[model samples]
Target: MGMNSVNTNAGAMIALQNLNTTNKDLGVTQARINTGLKIANAKDNGAIWAIAQNQRAESTSLNAVVSSLQRGQSVADVAMSAGSAISDILVQMKEKVLAATEAGLTTASKQALSDEYTALRNQIDTIANNATFDGVNLISSTTVNSASIKAIANADASATIDIAHANLSKTNTAIAATLSGLTGTVSAGDVTKLETAIQNVSSQLSKLGTGAKALDTHLTNVMKLQDTLDAGVGNLVDADLAKESAKLQALQTKQQLGVQALSIANQSSGILLGLFR
Candidate 1:
């Protein structure tokens, strides 16, 4: 430990330790700048990295939920559009029935009105059968109960938004069969049935509109939640580029100073040899 002893160089050991410390700090700063992440791995910050990983997984699962909701919304929209079209046809059929009920109508006119009425009723059945989206027909009895669409709200699949099926088929006796068997000889009963069919169609429309709105609201909320999750992950792992850049410059200067100090320390042993001479 003597100042002039060549056996042990304390100044050189101290300088070498400082240089190693500066190199380690420089490596850390360079890694942060290169990766753009303060906690790129669990080694950087184990608890924060684990939390960010879980949030990222949740965000990915929510994307799947959004996709399912979108598909369900599309099917609902198709069914609603078909229901509206059928309602318009029913109104026309009602007008034709009223015309046929007039006292002085000829047989030919009554037959013509009956044919038109039958055609309109058939069109309603056709619309119900064809109101499909992605092979899912909400208005068809065959497909209505086949599957219920659900939107997963969590990564664990414990929470969800359920969308029920709507069956408007003639065979289901929901809305399509309400206007069945109407001919040109319109009875008071036939007019009553037509009124009831109109009301049923209107009710179905309201239900569909409500379901669509609920889906839209759910989608909006899920999207907002996804944004929040992404922000949380960023807060946990993302690096500050400006801060890292400044730190890198400072570490580089410190490394150069360490090298100079180590060089000066190594020359101390040479100075001892000179003293002996």
Candidate 2:
């Protein structure tokens, strides 16, 4: 209470307390600057940290969902492209079959036409078998009910998007079976068979187009969701570097002033030594 006694220096106590407070403030500012996060740990703010952590987890899990969707898209695209090629080949085969059925055609011409048609028909099986992505084929299968491709639609694995297989090969489809029975001398019924094959190929193409579109739409939605989650996490944890920088400068200045104040306080007892002289 009095400058007369060196036993207790009140000014030094106050200055040291202020210096300690400034040091603590400086530490917090430095941490924010170093990490670029205001809530780097639970000690900064537990509730915000927890919320950001959850959002970060969700954003990370969406990476797997994106991979699944992309794989499904590739499979669908391969199937779609192969199916289109098959359709074109079917059209060409139909032209050969029609020419073979002409009334004036010689046996050699008819056999030549049949050979071309057979070659085109055989290509369908090759294309279908090769239409695969990531080891999954959507257009070729020996069984009546081929396994459908499924992709995860959400981060939690609770939902999925399913793409059904379209059997387009000689061993599975009725159109292929009908064409397999053709001879060198094509009949009017052969035209009918090609027509039916065209329609069936068109139908399968439509289905594949629909599935590909659906996958694209869902992928867009999932990507948007991931961006939103990332932004949410940023809002909860990201530091305003500009503000932190300003605060850091202010705290540094305060820290220097605090050290000077403590030095002045510590000299107070020495000043009383002049009284004894």
Candidate 3:
């Protein structure tokens, strides 16, 4: 009985050790699931985890660039919106002038009409001045928003994405003043100067339109690159829960068998001790 009791104690100890081992393994598997990541730390998959970290940094930077691009687009859109209103005013002014030329209109009526046109032109200038986002006036500043951003990697894997131009020409208040003087002042030289200002505005609008288009195309590309980077990051660190779950079951089975084997060993020790009788 004594020998058998010794065998049972030995078997219990062995069984306890196996239980501890399986408990540790299950704990690790559970951690993987809770975190939703495969390489939870560098110790898991050193090389791949490191690469995944670098990709995350790159993704963060790309997100910043996307924000900048969005602001720039808003500025361009404001300009386009203001331009439409200004164009309508200009058309009205041209009609009024034609009507005055055909009929014998009072000078006061013409002057009043001219004053309203001037006011409308000034309003356009105000719109351009105020169209800003996060303190960066894309329409009014000379700062180049079109920058090339590279993905973060061990070796600079240069993937150049050129952002859209800021369309900075709308900041000039002088153009508004010059264009406004065209209808109200009514001098031969003033008419010529005003026509020249109108032409200048037209040219600027053309350039800005082109810049807006460029930025739009770049924005689309940025979104595509973002998606690609996300996929790569997922590949590096994302866990496979299905596989891990299967492994957990297998380990549990083995742990149970180990306990049975240990119990048998302890019983053998008990039998040997019986010889003392």
Evaluate candidate 2 by giving its C-alpha RMSD to the native, one decimal. 1.9
Global Cα lDDT for candidate 3: 0.60
Residue-level lDDT tens digits of model 2 in 175-219: 654555235456898888888888898998898899899999999
The Cα error of candidate 2 at residue 130, in Å, is 0.9
1 or 3, greater by TM-score:
1
Per-model TM values vs. the true structure: 0.89, 0.95, 0.71
In candidate 1, what are the lDDT values of residues 43-146, reduced to their tens digit? 99899899999999999988888887788788788888998998898788778767776888888777788888878878877898888888777666674433
Clash numbers, per candidate: 0, 0, 3
Candidates arranged by TM-score, highest first:
2, 1, 3
Per-residue lDDT tens digits of candidate 3, residues 176-259? 434443333354444444455456556656766776676677777777787888899998888898988898788778778877
Q: Would you list the C-alpha lDDT of every candidate in the order shown?
A: 0.79, 0.86, 0.60
Find the candidate with the highest TM-score and give its number. 2
Q: Cα RMSD (Å) per model?
A: 2.3, 1.9, 5.8
**Deviation from native of the Cα of residue 184 in model 2, angstroms:** 4.5
